[model samples]
Target: MELQTLYNEYLNIKFKRGLPPVRTKPFEYGLYADDSAGLFLTDHPEETFTNWMYELIPRDPHYISAPDWQPVLADVFQQMDIYDELVLYYLLFTLNTTLSVNSHNAYSTMNDFMKNYSFLQLSHLSEITRLNEEQKHQVRDFFFFYYLYAHPVNEETLYACSFDGQNLVHTKTDIPLERYFTAFHDHYSTNIKEYTEQIAIAPHDIQACKHLTLQLLQCIEGKLAKLNMPEEKGLEAVLRLINDVDQMLQLHDNNKPALFEMMKNFLKEARSTPYRDHCFTTLLQNYASYILFFRFDEIHALVEYFEDTPEWCRTIINKIFMDTIFMERILRQKRIDITTYPNVTQFFEDEAKRIYL
Candidate 1:
């Protein structure tokens, strides 16, 4: 019933405001895709019609848990006056990220959505929801889930909810590294590999590596097939799609002898770490998996490789490690005897400031 009402209201606003009718899969993919349509309706349409248009963007299968939906929809209704576009976008985003997770259960799509949207916007939802004492504990638990798991930001938000008040101390939860890697492998595929032998055999010969890269690409395409990922989304295809060959090629160029040395030393060091459970064979397999998977953009080895550099360049190098899954995993593994830091954000920020300053 709500879906029909929402659809009817969308049509009414389109006719009244002379805006384009609803489009399916036509808008460019982004959070703001619906902003212009929303602004057109709110700017010129009748007040009642605009209010109707602001109804909850229904969840798929048209069901939302009472715990989740109540708080979210209340905030949407409360903020509909000023942040209409953002609220509408957030609903669509929630549907895509959290609600759509029934299919992609291994990895939380919420993390990606959190990366793109400002925490201030999220805090608004956190702020306006009026929860009872019993329900309040769940909010507190989920607060840590967002703070720890969401994309790290440089500075924290100012306005905080009761659950996420200023300077609230939250403990990070430790989940097994194998669990994370397994989920990631399942999502992408475990057949991904590092092409280590290929890299070692022809370090300086880019031509030789090209054939190896093509073989690697074919291997990836085959794995992606098992996962039902589109045929056109092979490693080379993603490179073309993003038009970022230079960065990846530069990564490839540096991998010749430099990457091999880094991998050997890193493996040597890992033998003593808590991750000692995974032998070199398993470690090499997973490392290779990530290298091939991260081929889309900003490709770096699971551990980065730096060519000959002076000691003073260490600060600059650490800054480069900021804001990557590789760095996050390194910190989590506790392998690399990095300077002790409280959290990934703090460590990354402190290192980043050294370079930026």
Candidate 2:
């Protein structure tokens, strides 16, 4: 059969079914030739045709399902050995269409559909191995976009509810990680000292300072975990402080002032302690990366610098920048001025230079 004849037949079938005619001429030709010849065609013909067709036509069966389309795609793949791209594109197209039609709860449905198809595993197939680096990257990018789109929420549900000044309340059980502060502030005050001293510190006279610090650290850990903050480094810092206090008390007869002094002295002395540095580094990194992405004008850039820094340093930086500088002079407001803080802009610029350089 002549390729044009087969092409006309395909179009006639679609036209008779009241479907829009396939507008991509090259794809129409490839489909007709590959199907009629039942042989692999090489050169750029197959790719050019497939790409044109895939781009022009909606892959959803509901909108335009040509029963013979799959065989045509298979023939093209069999001939050119680039089947995975076509398969993945089709899957994504279908998934996108499904979600679009069911917009209200599309995420759950799309996630369920993705779970059924192991595209990640299948992409590593021998056939796919033949694809060039660009093609591989295209596949990877598709999946990356798909994953991000399907799972829009990154944080936990703990912060979904706000406290109404009396009791804890949750707005949604399935709240994302980004909404953590709404929940945290609902139950507890932002005054870190209140939570740490009241809830964390043990009241018994016989309780070792090290034990109290450890318990306090546990409370911090629990709260942070609820915030969906990764726990490894933060927990390690707490443990290190606890162990250091334990050793100091054993040698210095349980001197509370001495222990507090030691903590202060350690921060002052090391100036380069790995844990302390890590805290600051994490703070800066998270602020620069995550906060900027969210475009939050309220949070100062210095917040990131102080994130991985010691809790004490965080307090000090906040007091100096937020309380004294931004609140008192920069914006001249009694409250901290979130917008137009020059120091924060300078700090963020400096951090960016340090990072890039």
Best TM-score goes to which candidate?
1
Clashes of each: 1, 10
lDDT of 1 by residue, 1-357 (tens): 122233233333422333344432111111123332331112223221112212323343224344233322233234222222233323223222221112112243334333222221222222222334343343333333343345322122111212322223111212222222223223222222344321222222222222222222222112111111111211232222112223323444565444344334543443342112212222232222223323312222222333233221242234335322334443343343344322322323454546322
RMSD to the native, candidate 1? Answer: 22.8
Q: Each prediction's Cα lDDT score?
A: 0.28, 0.31
Q: Which portions of model 2 miss their true places by more than 4 Å?
A: 1-276, 287-292, 301-341, 348-357
* Candidate 1: pairs in clash: 194-288
| lDDT (tens digit, per residue) of candidate 2 on 20-82 | 444432223222422221111122243321121233232444444443345223432333122
Give per-residue lDDT, candidate 2, residue 80: 18
- Candidate maximizing lDDT: 2
In model 1, state the lDDT of residue 220: 19
lDDT at position 16, candidate 2: 30
